[model samples]
Target: MSVRSLPSPADDPSTDIPPPPEYDGNLPFAAAGPEPARTGGERLYVAMTGAIVAGPFLALGVGGWLLWGRLIHPADLLLALGLYTITGLGVTVGFHRGLTHGSYTARRSVRIALAVAGSMSFQGDVIGWVAIHRRHHAFTDRPGDPHSPYRYGTHLRGQLRGLVHSHVGWLFRNERTPADRYAPDLLADRDIRAVSRAFPALCLLTLALPFGVGWAIGGTWTYALTALLWAGLVRIALLHHVTWSVNSLCHLIGERPFRTHRHDRATNLWPLALLSFGESWHNLHHADPTSARHGVDHGQIDPSAAVIRLLERLGWVRDVRWPTPDRIDARRA
Candidate 1:
């Protein structure tokens, strides 16, 4: 006996459900909200900038003249360089890699060390830095991005203006990224909360530590003062620009070899490779968000990755997601 096919949903018009509402594909532009009232931190950052400018000039004019009239010591320069390198790495490896990305898990002692060292950078508390960084990744190059070099219209002058805005002007602006939305995890952590609260004390120590070291090493107040000037103030200013470059210059320039869903203009600028501790490998980072290592390829010098590897070997960190050839191939543009 011949059998007939039962009616399908498409054949039965009455049984059909209405199609879901069509998205126009145009994302609604979020309105610029009322300017936020400045916080103590905001005022502090401004005051610090002013102090950095004036302090250096005054030191050069008065202190430098006095020291020059007497004699210049080599030990002072060594102390400055040493302190700058250590503290700068603390911000880069501790704040950027370990805290912000969770590239690898560290032991309690390591975690505390990283947190304390990062705090010494005076960039802000760990939570604040991570919050703003997460927001930067979330919005990137778009209107809501914290420091997109493309904020202004695409013109020679506009891009130049935008670059300057991205580099340092964005920090001076009163807008604050919502900590609850971007960094709830950090805010909830007791250790992080305590460390963040102790930021004022950390800032004082950051400046003082260099001076103390210089005095102990050279046995002179003049040497300690010079160390403080170079290591404390100048180092911070230099690192600030290096970190900011990843936001402004990395986006606007560099090669985009990997595909991305977001309007992320991040690139791997080799020039900033060593200084940024392999953070210049931005394209791969955006491609594989959770990967522990950014500098995946051979001949790419990633000091941070080396540090992580050493930590893993020492059993201080585990579950590192190093890049595989297959994964790299998959992300290839």
Candidate 2:
């Protein structure tokens, strides 16, 4: 029996292959992960989704301070920070690790809550989000990767162009990765499908939630509006930039402790450790997507992993893919 050696990460399958076809519905999880190497374009007709929201965010933040002498109340500050923690974990733990990679199995209720909380982050609908992310992994830094920062050549102008596109310009794109091809398991999950559909409603609810709490506490419209601006808009803006930085800065400049043979440009940015919910451990993530804990080393803080650990103790998550020493040693650059 001839055992096949794993392909060197430097030797990514670069040829364009057709994306996997849709199954006849209800494919099991193990069989549904994206296969290797598949694929298109540059454009300026992008929808600018993030920019549109940021305009309003900046306006509210500055205008409120100038006119009302208050940009955010103390309660508003707390509300934003608290919600940011929840929704950020929802993306890092729930969406990226649990749902997208099956890094762990969560209780049905916990899974559902994670999806709902992830929707509150306003990143994308569940199915679409999974599809785009899965496609990103399947292609990595190769041509077909949806968010590769090296889309343009590595020359100065090309790098600049590529950075912009990868960071947020991709948001303007009308092209979407087909869920059946990249995220078939999520598409097949009824809970995920429902959450994907409820994205718009969830957005409304998330934004309104802080306002409601503030109004109830203070019994004033001023407090309600202030909370809405800070917790709702400003918080979204902050998380957006942090999440986008993974696609942008993490790929460009950071410590590459885990060598991936240039298959992709993921790096671990220690500065982003806390802000990104431990997701700045990017090189490790691309090296082993199924590992539930990305910050594998001692002294590295991973609040999301801590959450998963707590849940595991409480029987809320199982089959966590904590990195073993052997696995870590094998992947060291």
Candidate 3:
């Protein structure tokens, strides 16, 4: 070309100059991205707790007028006791020890059975239960512990309030331990994750199953309705209190025979032993989290341990972490 070409923007040396700083596209004091949205799950959890608590109070008012008065039926009492035992053991043995703690393995069939039975208790999905429990162990009586009774203080009034706080009030709170942090293993398990997601359906079945059984047994609508009240609602309420007591009463008022950190006030309350499937041996549990047998001493009467033994005998479970004499002695205070 005869004419000299003007310097294009890209070819020009001055074009390399940095652009002027502009506030149009960015904030002067901006930090990173916005925080995550709070889940509405806590509202649902609070509603659930309220319903469970209110159910018992209402039942007591009505049932006292009906059952405890001249209309009492022994079958109702028996049904309550029987259902409580069945579902209580399902939570303690099947959910806590077997699923959450992995104290012992189970056959595929036993695993499925325990999952179903535990779901019938209406506590929660296996994964959520395990997640909260694992967090408790990871931060026993500390800031992150899900239901530490000592969160209030050491004074009598504070401790009393804390006891109630830990026992049942904590369930109404919105705070939740992260599933990824505490229960990644369970979260990764397809079966456990699925079961956890089916919690509402399982709870519905928990109520309905007792009603169906009562109908079959008594061949009457009244019997079925009464059974649902006693076995389903009352049983759930009672078990809820007993289990929550371990987190509250067991920690606050028992003999700490097994040495542990001062902050970890886990103790064995003998009165709750039989009813809790030997979980009242709390001192030994904190001392040795992996032990399949919590009631390690003679005459401790761990029904759960007995069941584990039977399962092991049948080759349904292996590699059980049973307590040894040395281990027990080492943990003695």
Q: What TM-scores do the predictions have?
A: 0.82, 0.84, 0.84
Query: Quick one: ranking by TM-score, best first?
Result: 2, 3, 1
Off by over 4 Å in 1: 1-45, 48-72
Ranking by lDDT: 2, 3, 1
Q: Could you give the C-alpha RMSD of every candidate to the true structure, in order shown?
A: 10.8, 8.8, 16.4
Query: For each candidate, what is the lDDT?
Result: 0.71, 0.76, 0.73
What is residue 59's positional error in candidate 1, in angstroms? 7.4
Q: Which ten residues in a row have the lowest lDDT in candidate 1?
A: 1-10
Query: TM-score of model 3 relative to the true fold?
Result: 0.84
C-alpha positional error of residue 315 in candidate 3 after TM-score superposition, expressed in Å: 2.2
lDDT by residue for model 3 (188-300), tens: 66776677788888889888877888888888998787888877777777777778889998888988889864357888999989878889998898887767899988788
Q: Model 1 over residues 1-333: C-alpha lDDT tens digits?
A: 000121211223342333223311123223377767768987897788667444544555554565677644566567656665666667766776677666667777887788888888767888898778766766556666778777674577768888988887787774678888667777767788898999889989988987887788778887787777666666666566677788888887888888654456788888988888788888888777556788887777887788879889999977676878999989988
Residue 227, model 3: Cα distance from true site in angstroms: 0.6
Can you list the residue pairs that collide in candidate 2? 47-172
